[model samples]
Target: MPLNKKLAEKLNKRFAPDSRLDDTYQGLDLTYITNELGEPITLFIGKRRPDGAITGERYVRTIKRVPNSDQIASSHWDLKGKVSRS
Candidate 1:
């Protein structure tokens, strides 16, 4: 199944990115993570097409976290040919 609106909203709030759709995978397929409990987790934003289409299948390549990592006030995203960290 494809990512849904509720899950997308949750990821959006967590990242609260200036733009929600900014990558290239979601359009082609679904990407995601499942927690230890086996629940799906979204670690990145969706992709936005030039035509203004918002898709929930996109994702980040290396979603990692370190304790006390350089205090990022907000989540981030970057796309340079491929989606990556900001």
Candidate 2:
């Protein structure tokens, strides 16, 4: 399923305060945060880990960010996706 507009908007507001995503764009498997001039800032990718005690698994990722732009780029391994700002 695609991400709801309201939820996406909220995330965009939280992550990319200076810019807004297009309404037509659906759920994002990956998201990148770029500077106003379109420079890469950070990279985040998702991962899944097995939990022996739990019925299901947990998802997480290691994020890398650049101090200069304070932006972020994220990818989802489970979803097999990647997003880059520049």
Candidate 3:
């Protein structure tokens, strides 16, 4: 399922300073989904077409909350080995 309104907005603001979303991915067409445990995961990242459809690279990163804070942060989120579309 897609992220909820509040959560989506929070994530967008948190990831706003991410340069990789532009320099590396070439665009900010990212989608965030949470797992059963409510942990945010970045499932897709790519470019958004004129029609507002996102199409591109897929990722699998389990985001975690920062120690002593409510803020979530990713560590070594860079794409690594084969990431199957599944």
Candidate 4:
């Protein structure tokens, strides 16, 4: 996937190598899919195990752009599949 340059710049501060936007955690890795306009639309969240295996969770994270601005007013994360405890 191509990098979202505009969003990345806003997500990190000068001199900061890390992204302010949430991506990964102790055992989970996240990948994103963007639209033609370079906006993130889909997310693939994977959970890593000690046995070198991974489990995945698909989600939709929609960004609401602020009217007449380059800023995102808000965003929402919604799980894609049926909800259940494993």
Return model 3's CA RMSD, one decimal.
Answer: 10.2
Off by over 4 Å in 4: 1-24, 35-39, 47-55, 82-86
Ranking of candidates on TM-score, top first: 4, 3, 1, 2
Candidate number with the higher TM-score (2 or 4): 4
RMSD of 2: 12.6
Candidate 4 residue lDDT tens string, 1-86? 33245534432223222222235644556555565455556655576445433357666766788899857788666678532224
Cα RMSD (Å) between model 1 and the true structure?
Answer: 11.8
TM-score of 2: 0.22
Where is model 2 poorest over a 10-residue stretch in terms of lDDT?
Answer: 48-57
lDDT of 4 at 2: 30
TM-score of each: 0.24, 0.22, 0.35, 0.47
**Model 2, stretches more than 4 Å misplaced?**
1-54, 74-86
lDDT of 3 by residue, 1-86 (tens): 33334534444344433223322222355555555444434545556556544466554554567898766665323343333233
Question: How much does candidate 1 score in TM-score?
Answer: 0.24
Which ranges of candidate 1 are over 4 A from the true structure? 1-27, 43-86
Q: Candidate 3, which segments miss by more than 4 Å at Cα? A: 1-27, 50-53, 62-86
Per-residue lDDT tens digits for candidate 2, residues 1-86, read: 33344633433333443342222123323333444544322223222123212112122323345666555564221222433332
Candidate 1 residue-wise lDDT, 22-56, digit = tens: 33333443344444323334344455445555343
- lDDT at 18, model 4: 25
Alpha-carbon lDDT of model 3? 0.46
Q: Model 3, poorest ten-residue lDDT window?
A: 17-26
Q: Give all candidates' CA lDDT scores.
A: 0.40, 0.33, 0.46, 0.52
